[model samples]
Target: MRFARAIALGAVTAVTGGLLAAVPAAAQATGAPAASAAATVSVTLTGKAVRADGRAVDEVGVFVVPAARWVDEDAAPVSTALVADNGRYSVTASVAAGSSLYVRVDDWTSSDGYMDRLFVGKGGKAAFTYVGLAPIAAKAGTIELGTATAPKLSTVRVTTSAPVHCAKLLRKNGTLAAMECDYTVDKKVFTFTGMYPGEYTVGAMWSSWTDARATVDVSAKKGVTTAAMLTLESPTTMTGVVQDTQGKALEGIAVWANGPDSPRTVTDATGRYAFKGLTAGSYVVDYSGASGMSSAYRDYVTRTSTVSVTSGRVTTAGSTLTKGAQVTGSVTPLAKETYGTIVALAADGHVLASDSYWSSDGKKRDFALHGLPTGTHTVVVQDAASGRYAKSTVVVSGTSARTVGALKPAAAPVTVRGTVEGTTAGFVSLRYGTSPLYRGAIDGGDVKPDGSYAITHVVPGIYALRSHRTTSTAGYEGNLLSVTVGDGVAVRRIPQPTRKVQTLQTLVRTSVTFDGRALPGVVPLPRRTPADLWGNWTNEKGVGQAPWTGRAWDAVVLEDVFFAYHSPYYFVVKSPTSVTKPGDLANVTVARVAGGPTV
Candidate 1:
């Protein structure tokens, strides 16, 4: 395409000015005079143009294509209009009483990641339909063409037992860029338009009837519409506190919810972690514990179960994470003529500790990997811009680390080109080195809008192809790809799998407890006044929650007097359905949190 931003002012003025502008004055004066009774045979074409997701599409060009030929003239457009933000457009054209036309959308750029400019007309597989104009005996005529939808994304409908409130359909990479909320308050089914065919997760907010958030994975097939069915269940909360072997709080530690939903958050100043709005399910709170070059000390984990969280209640899954060995190191790039460096200590392709070192105007690279898991790990380092780097493997004893003195040079340049088809706006990476922990990059760049990408000047060698969305998950379907490229372009199709990853089912939340003390999960600030809980919430009024952020409060009361305390309520769900009291669930065994075997 041809994209014309706006019609010229003079042409528009003349067309509206007199008959000489639209047609010859002598012909109009003889046959049909402009703005006269004979020329009053006009047709108004109007409609709303939209994207697949039901969002209004603006700046689309609309045309009235002639459906029936006139005397010696071919079928063609008699008028045009531009779609507005509300997706509405109106065009008035003068024609004979029996003249007919089809409403067609003209060429325009689509923001929905289509490579080519849009060509949506009759029989183009467009999601829109052209309306046929009929003869009008009245002076005024109107032809309502209804709605025109763009043919970009596939629509996925989520049918739930309860109406999903404030629900959003998340993409495979767990980002909102693919499709946000097609919220339904009381409707049982929610339709999410503007979705590319891929795996997705659908979740709803707090519901009055059932406790669970009704989160489910939709394994959308390629070119197939996904209609998912999910039921609501009881909802619950999980909380815990992590501390060092010396009983000191380890604030700012990363606590991950390893289950159906992998939502992660950091500990507060009190070393307490809280996970709210989760369906009752089995879950593990993996804390950042002792590892790497520790000061030659032994490590151990605590006790834990088939933890159950009850509906309309908070379940405490407290965990005591004893600090592990600390590993630290630095990176010194070989050359300064590059972008930056990403140094990671990876074990089994999972990054234990990672940090980036960008080139300053006059500084050298310094990267450190702290608390690397015990045993051996690959220290992968590469230039961010040029993809040149080095790697080495080292074994970590009790808290320990080693210096990877100098970096290695990158390989020769090669061109790797391929079509990357997925909803993820991800990039294709040409990586040279790989460990179970991480893939060391050689060079990488973004995939274009046309589903194609080319990494020029890549070092010619055998490299692993990794396509990744914004999230940690690689959007591509298959395993790590291996390709051999010479000095020129190498073509490959990286198939993105539509595999449905199973999330841990919701069970009663459980926490490991020893010595009769439950682990403290929800750390609450002191309740100072009535305004803190009731209303007039202010961030600066010393609500006792200044330093702590991202905390999920169980409940606040304005009863006699609201006094903020320091500790959150810790409730551990020993069992959900079987346990009325603490003694009813002795059958569900427990594992002592001891030193886990080093990988």
Candidate 2:
């Protein structure tokens, strides 16, 4: 997810009723003239960062950068800070005369993270970058340094109904302040300070625990106490076996189960399989061979069974495999052909057997395939020797043998023939919507020197096509195309889009690095501003917007906010970085208030 800076540029006007009566002489030394000398101007920046459930984010990182360098190389951040505990922050900066400002806020928690970028001034309206994260921006608001109130701190108690694994609780600004754990029988508790009155969410993890989650709200007048109960449930197990058509134990044959709330599991080496932690529900057991043999060899054996597990219980089921029929065919190359190919496909387009061999003396070639189920089959023959092919369907009975007579080579289509360009040479499948109807490569199609080619005899329907290129030189490979196939459809040449084009730009709060490599996760900022600086800054005056540095590849805006910043005129620079996992960083670049935009 991308992170962005929120920058608001407005004229700093004097407070009402002579609030700036003691305007210091040094104020002019920083380039801002006195109230009487020039228009007394003030900027206020304020906003909130919370989870999707409206819980206040604590200790998240936030920053503000100039609009010019939000996504560029030059305009790096100039101001940064951590948000307070209440998910609210305020910053007030007195800008010199005739200057513009940009503000940005970013959260780096794994859930509902966001990076927002906005500009404030007479120059232009604010622009947003929705890379992967979503940001909320506050509209124009008045700021009174003299009347603003400091953020109040309070305490919150979090309790779980049952004993949980007890990971660590984190603030929105990506800070690990303390280590908390409890091995008690029933519950665990944690208290936080310097938190403003607001809604906050706590996350906990536990093993063998079920239905354990909760939320709480805190306020200054009445400190909030939240509790979550953990429920314990027993897990059920399923065991089964697989065998071949001759009633012999088929070791290593893959077996799987699919059903409500059950993930797929593979059988063991002894052809025995077991599914653990299965909730009380109905499940379907599916068995197949490692080579993916067709139903003829008992390709798939499925049984639906229900098991009621009370705490701990073992359920057992057995499966058997049956024999299928055999199919034999011949590949005859045309006069000018060089190679003969034959493929036997099932009703569902599963390749049961396929083989390609060099033509001997340019004569007809014979091939045989065993272990096929009794059913209708689609046979594809390609005579690469003469650049010709044909497709036909045949039926085979489990008890009898089936044969396909000599297939006469057909004339290639001249008017409608094209090749798939910009893709590696692999299987280019074409299918017509929600149906089992489709055709592979064109049997008889004209050839062109260029990759451009077309096809004929296309039926009418909503046709969707895609190419699976075995080898791809660029990211544009494996492209998909959707088209409408009405009666006598003629598809002209369509060009594929390249991946080099960028549709959006995103800004991130903190740069992440893993094993000395940059990862893609934002660092959160605090939501509340400091108490000492309260009443001296408006929410809008202290708002920060980070600029888009031409670095990070893709941004993942976390849901929590912990970082904070003041002054909309500052900027932060970011470079494209990637991380393999989370919480793996050794070095990072952070800029605090050094010489610019101080009250």
- Judged by whole-model lDDT over C-alpha atoms, candidate 1 comes out at 0.43
Over the stretch 1-599, how does candidate 1's per-residue lDDT look in tens digits? 11211110000001122111222223211222222234446767667766545656554433332221111111234566667777787777776543323444543454342211122322222321121112122235776656666545346677877544445564322222232233222456666553433446676654322224456877544224679877766446667776676777666565655554445665666767666566656665556532221222123221222346664577765556543344345556555554544444434343455566766542465655655556776665656666565667777665554665544535444578887767345677766534322334556767677777788765444567766554332223335677876666799888653443321111122322211222121112213221222222211111211111122223321111110110010111222222333223222211111110100
Per-model lDDT: 0.43, 0.38
Which digits, one per residue and each the tens of the lDDT, describe model 2 over residues 373-456? 678876667666443566667787764567777664453412333455653243334543322222233332322445554555
Count of backbone clashes for each model? 55, 112
Write down the TM-score of every candidate. 0.35, 0.32
lDDT at 559, model 2: 20
